[model samples]
Target: MSAAGGGSAGSIRIDRLLVYLRFARTRSAALALIDTHALRRNRKHVLRASEQVRIGDVLTIALGSGVRVVELLALPPRRGSPAEAASHYREVDSDGLDRKGQMTIGASSPAPGILSGDPEDFS
Candidate 1:
């Protein structure tokens, strides 16, 4: 789903997407992440930085300390502020772990108030 204010409507290069979403500080960093096989799109290894990713795609990124699984809610037109970039995707607890990476007893829910609206909308 595109953003309310006319966001990009087609697939985006994964490297660019990473920068736009603030996953990486720069495009080169994003490429390095991909080169190291630290990113997976829909559970499959991302072979290149140019791999296309669209709205609703789930990305599992292995960061320095932990993993981050996020679903693209919208493709931002540019790399905006932290809050704006945050609104473009939703963090997902794919492994049923909480903030500390410990297993949870019940369903995993997105962090409250990080973004407005139901995350299930992307599902």
Candidate 2:
């Protein structure tokens, strides 16, 4: 039995997770995002869309403008409301000051050579 308590296990496909968590608008979009090789799982680059992301996994996603890091809090059963989806993961704001009131290092710039917003680039 997985941590989710059911026999299905507490894991979801990375592509599906992206949509479920409102990160990617659709599965195809998620795949395109994945193709960029900019998404990282637990600090390791995610090379495929079929990879599994379990509860508590940390995901670092490079967006069009910046990178966002999130720690999985739960495995969403489905693509729910934004609020519900937001509940499944906690953002790890590395750019902000830490508890010690010191600057923490984080990816504050967009990924170089990765055209994130141009739909024409993916074609």
Candidate 3:
């Protein structure tokens, strides 16, 4: 396979991609999303779950109501904790905000849910 963007000799592999996908909690989600034609790499639609991914490559994954574009920065040989996995990729510039001026689905949200429930409700 061809390694573009100054990729390291051992950085191109499907397993590495899997590690990132799992880290993102999207391994199964991404696979199912791919089957529905909801995933793209470098702007081209990708259907294979085992396709090799390289550093600096852009991955656009279709979410509930929007898409997220993540730029690969490094490809490690094995999976690690959340913090370690986060270092594997970088959010691309165009990956933010949707065309409608709303926040992209994957962008961080203020703490989930409202704090209106009664404190005594919990055991």
TM of each candidate vs. truth: 0.70, 0.71, 0.57
Model 1: clashing residue pairs?
Answer: none
Model 3 regions more than 4 Å off: 1-28, 95-123
Q: Measured by TM-score, how close is model 1 to the native structure?
A: 0.70
- Report the number of the highest-TM-score candidate: 2
What's the lDDT for all of these models?
0.68, 0.71, 0.52
Rank list by lDDT: 2, 1, 3
The total number of steric clashes, by the backbone 3 Å criterion, in model 2 comes to 0
Tens digits of per-residue lDDT, candidate 2, 16-84, equal 888777777777878877776758887777788888888878888877767777999998888787778
Q: Considering summed lDDT, which 10 consecutive residues are worst modelled in model 1?
A: 107-116
> Which lDDT tens digits does candidate 3 get at residues 82-114?
557557777666635245633332422112221
- lDDT preference between candidates 2 and 3, better one: 2
Residue-level lDDT of model 1, residues 1-123, one tens digit each, is: 344223345778888888777777677878777776767888778998778888889887776545678899987878887788889998887564234633222212222211212334212
Clash count, predicted structure 1: 0
Arranged by TM-score, best first:
2, 1, 3
